[model samples]
Target: MRIRNSVIVITGAASGVGRATALHFARHRVSLVLASRRVEALEALVAECQALGSRAIAVPTDTSEYDDVRQLASRAVQEYGRIDIWVNNAAVSFFSPFLAVPMADFRRVIDVNVMGYVHGARVALERMQDQGAGVVVNVASIVGAVPQPYTSAYSVSKAAVRALGVSLGSELGLDRQKHIHVCTVLPPTIDTPFFQHAANYTGRRAVAMPPVYSPERVAKAILRLAERPRHELVVGRLGRSMVRQHRLMPGRMEKVMAHQVENTHLSKKQAADPSSGNLYAPSLDPATAQVTGGWKGRRRSARRTLAGAALLGVGVVVLADRLRTART
Candidate 1:
């Protein structure tokens, strides 16, 4: 669809991929509805979009609340007269072993990551059904397909998000609502403030795993989805490879991921005390809310990771052969 003069609603527009996506749509001269709990951040982003020659509004929304999400949709329609595209991008992460994670924290993660998307999709669909067409873009992570240790809740929630899109799309097809499209995006570890805002109970600093890509990449994928909806779009090379490898060799991939999470996803440096982050409430100070995570993640190449894993397997077989020969 032509983005110029299109109406787009983006949740979690305060920072990270949502912020970048909002700016990207703004550049296309779309009418934008920006939602997040941080009113200050949302206001600033609205101004930025306006400066780019787009009509934009700031809606302080808590996605976990169904009412708030409904109001967001209502407000957008009230101002723009219709909803064209809805991007369900608000989410929270929890870092801890599944058994060690608090029940409340796990539930909160589900509330935001999974149910939040559900609410947005429902509201958008209602308006779209009335209008006879619309697109819904869901931002799920690679973890949705390949689970990561110490963040079981987050992984499960993202997986549910992906399933939500697929199931919803099928239901729409059954009704012959072909004009309504559901697209899911699976992004790699991104350079965002996600780590800083995550609920951490691991007693270690959290960081995006290697091969982190800029949020702009994911934002670009979202824009493409708006134009032409696809079933699922994987954002980065590393994320795509990981998904393929896990499907091919689940057992070996599990070992590799376990090592990667324990070593690369956490920092050995002393970490600050654990907190609930924004899971229960907004934790980002409005004054400091920004897009980048300021995390200079490890500079490991995606090719190197694949090559190293292959070399390790070869070396293991050769060493076993040498040991057997020596024993003989």
Candidate 2:
């Protein structure tokens, strides 16, 4: 399945990996139905893609809402006549200790991460089945592949996405219309606003994760997945290896991730400041093609390129934690 000129629906398209993927497909002349909560941001992306000669529309959407997602699917089909691919990338994270983690935060994370994917899956499945061919991509996290400390709810949600992908993949294989493919993408902490934006109980600066990847790399992997139609893709090599290591050496891996949870810290946290955490999704500062690898779109975060910078910036090298996280 070629990517060029195909109609694609991408959730979380306002920024991060989804934004990069949207621009990537646009570069290839794909028609796009992009959805996100940020209407201005989505509109900006659509404008950029249109400048690149792709027909793209921005739809302000809350994936957690079933009707909104169904509407998104319907809009894509109505505008483009068919839905070739659907990417579910919207998500939230919780960083307090499991017992202390707020129930509201936990529920919100589940609703957006797990339930959002469910909505996308349900909508895309119907359209794809009717069209006789289509694809769905679930953007999960490597944290869910194996349990880590402080992010218990986030881990649980991601694991559910992985499980859902496995289930959907099997179901599609056995379905009468075998062209409906289900794919999941699991990546480690990428250089995005996720750290600063992640919900935390600790009052301080953003706690860091291990080495992170560029959203562009993950976007490229997703584009490849769209073409090849794989069941699951782990973006970062180290993240993938860590998941395998955890499976074989649970005790050791647990200790490692435990230390990570303990060591991460935040820059500035104010319990009194009532700004909603959702206001700060991981964002990118899109630069010239020279620095960000040809993605000169609006507000895109560049992955660390220098070996030392990459090691230092990503959550991989940092263990300093000023915040709290939920445990298993």
Give the whole-model CA lDDT for all candidates, comma-separated.
0.87, 0.75
Tell me how far the alpha carbon of residue 124 in candidate 1 is from the true structure, in angstroms, after superposition: 0.5
As for candidate 1, its clashing pairs are none
Each prediction's TM-score against the native?
0.91, 0.82
Estimate candidate 2's alpha-carbon lDDT, on a 0 to 1 scale: 0.75
After superposition, the stretches of candidate 2 with alpha carbons farther than 4 Å from their true spots are: 265-276, 279-328
lDDT of 1 at 261: 84
lDDT of 2 by residue, 1-328 (tens): 7898899999988777788888888999989999988777788889998999899998888988899998998899899999999999988776666787678778888888999999999999898888888889999988877677767778899999999999998888777556779999998766555554567765544544545567787888889889998989988666676676677556666666666556643334334232236723433333311112222222222322332243333333323331232221
